[model samples]
Target: MNFANTGQMEITTLENFYRDTASLIPEGINKEIGHFNVFKIEDVLARQNKKVMPYNRRAYYKISVISGKNKAEYADKVIDIEHNALLFATPKIPYNYVPQDDDQHGFFCIFTDEFLIQSKSGVVLDDLPLFQPGGYPIFQLSAEEVDDITFIFRKMYKELSSDYAYKYDLIRNYILELIHYGQKLQPATTLYPSHTASARVSSLFIELLERQFPIESPQQKLNLRTAKDYADRLAVHVNHLNKVLKENTGKTTTDIITGRIVQEAKILLKQTDWNISEIAYSLGFEQVAHFSNFFRKQTSFAPLAFRS
Candidate 1:
């Protein structure tokens, strides 16, 4: 369990993201009710060895039931997954799962992004608030609701494995139905601010923050890619943008900006094989020392020490 120098594992494709990870359950063993590729795993467990990351441009999502001693962190929150309960993972965000102790049983299904997009007509996946990276995932499902979702997954799985033509089309439709159901179930507002007139400004700031950092790539050092850069792109006064973000997320514009940079730094520190200099440069720093100092100020540990 001592991964002293944990190397970065990049998942740029769907197949690349899930390879060797999912196990298919045998027939007549686990009760599968969904129409999708529902895999029921009993008494099996896994802990994320490295940072759990996935690229989901293809619009994939995951639904899982974690019974027994299993937990996962979606951002900063740790969730205890219970029996018959539902947890969702959208493609845009990255998450990590760690086992608390030992035995656990669960069923999980992965469906493509197109499955959800179809039902929305002209709408995009990004339009779905729940699919956003920082949003929460755990949903307490009623028995009837759980059964309904499971049945949809089962149907999808059956059609996926069938010999009939246009089976994929049917399967995709089922998956879309599942997400539409989820969208219906989701709360109208987020725990974070969403209704302020400045909310759009905050959202744009987030998108800009995300665009500045590509996953697992070492390009530049953490060279104080400051609020000015973001302000310029937004075509707004730095003070105005800062005021908007402060009113919304309770964080200043610079704080929000640097917070994002430091987060990517932590991911790079723990998951990638890159050295300090390369990581620094990748983060837009001119020198490794500057990145180290900034990281230490934020985290109280140097990048290397934090990874260890």
Candidate 2:
């Protein structure tokens, strides 16, 4: 019920996901070639100790065909799915999947970007409209479309458990098939209005901001640190970006950017053993003192104090 903690959402790794759901990893999975797995939605739900899915970014890509009533909460929006739908989720955004009824039946497949690299599918996952930030990635499905999707998922499940040597290659083709299928249908974009240029710019700014996050290492520094930097990347004036964001989100550009940085700082402080300097540098602060000041001003707690 509390969405406030959503700001401090952590990235869910595959190991933790499997352990949390009590789902067994298939024996023949090769992590080096990139991990890929498919599961029946009911089977996964039945094995879980709790039915709740947290609001967090996954470290892998996921495509799900969900049939039933459900609610999906993203950082800036909430979508109520009343029927069968295909959902595509990328690692860049955080979302919470909440089922509203007990009659849920579907399938979901999670795979790393590496999983598709070997296939040379020529389709960059990020370039796809479905996985783009602020793009409508969920599609409402008709009964026939649902049957087509279900058939693909079932084939994936079947091939995954088989003894065939070229099964992964075949599986990759099926994944591409689903991707193409979803592309052919219209995205449920009407659910989120982007009717104006300002709205579109605001969406792009937010996407650019989100793409820099989940900093995997202390060595990975934040790229676009300021509103001006984002404006340049977006080919818009800084004033224009700020005004658009203010009109759309009721927050200035700096407010949104700093708020996100503070959120990531909090996550790093609590989740990792990284020192203050490492965390500060990663968040684009040149000095630990500056980061400390920013943290105290924003969250009213020093980084170390919050960690303790």
Candidate 3:
């Protein structure tokens, strides 16, 4: 598939995916996943993109675990997924599936924002960390934790297909429970924090910084990826964010943000076959020359030189 800027499905209706995959569900099992009908499929076919698709660009996020050997190409990273593990998939990202040797046990339940976040839970749901389209999902749950989660999903399946008035509400609660459990499972990253203004700002700033990194598309390139852009989004002055970062992390906001961007640049440069111009564009640099100048100033080497 053409991975660059394929708006093939923008926030696809979950109901339609359910209808299409209806035949995949095994017979005679009532499975409820987030207030919608749950379809359990062992064989899944989807698109896989080259390293140019946006990280947050996906219609639905997936949580999967399998024992059979599997291979995935995400950007410049090709991973051998052969053990019990959990990972995420965004709708905007292009990905494909291959089941190895037919000995695989996997479960996936698809839901839209409508199904997950209703009136009461939507506000809190917005703060959830895994839902971040661009964030990481490398949590390694303990065997007990995995079993617990599986049991919850099994119960959710039963509730989903039942004819009950409050099934939706119960599903919402179950969804919230899963999110809470995930929050506990997440690494001690700064993404999970107590409620505080500065903490909130820091979290938002980190998200904004991550969104620009591991550059994905040319048109989505970063000409204006700077502290000011983030300040505007946070509704705080640039200096204020810098001060917050300095006070919070012992570094200026520019240092932290630029450091993150540069780190990603180093990874893409050294690892990917994508050229300098492509990397620059993905990082939102309007001109490759400008990106080169900035890269040299920060790392004492031009983007191309560093890659070589």
Error of 2 at 5 (Å): 21
Model 2: per-residue lDDT, tens digit, 178-266? Answer: 98888778444533467799999987887789889777678889999999999999999999999999999899999999988887886
Ranking by lDDT: 2, 1, 3
Q: Superposing all C-alpha atoms, what RMSD in Å does each candidate have to the true structure?
A: 7.0, 7.2, 7.1
The Cα error of candidate 3 at residue 155, in Å, is 2.6
- TM accuracy, model 1: 0.76
The 10-residue segment of model 2 with minimum total lDDT is 1-10
Tens digits of per-residue lDDT, candidate 1, 44-133, equal 235323323232222246766554445666644566655445567764455656555456455666655544454445656555655666
TM-score of every model? 0.76, 0.69, 0.60
Candidate 3 residues lying further than 4 Å off, grouped into runs, are 1-41, 45-56, 65-82, 87-102, 123-126, 133-135, 159-167, 187-200, 207-224, 229-240, 246-252, 259-283, 292-308
Give the 10-residue window scoring lowest on summed lDDT in candidate 1.
1-10
Number of colliding residue pairs in each model: 36, 0, 18
Q: Candidate 3, overall lDDT? A: 0.58
> How many angstroms is residue 73 displaced in model 2 relative to the true structure, after the best TM-score fit?
1.5
Better of 1 and 2 by TM-score: 1
User: Which one is best on lDDT?
Assistant: 2
Where model 1 places Cα greater than 4 Å from the true spot, the runs are 1-9, 12-38, 43-60, 75-77, 101-103, 111-120, 142-144, 191-197, 220-224
lDDT of 1: 0.62
lDDT against the true structure, each candidate = 0.62, 0.83, 0.58
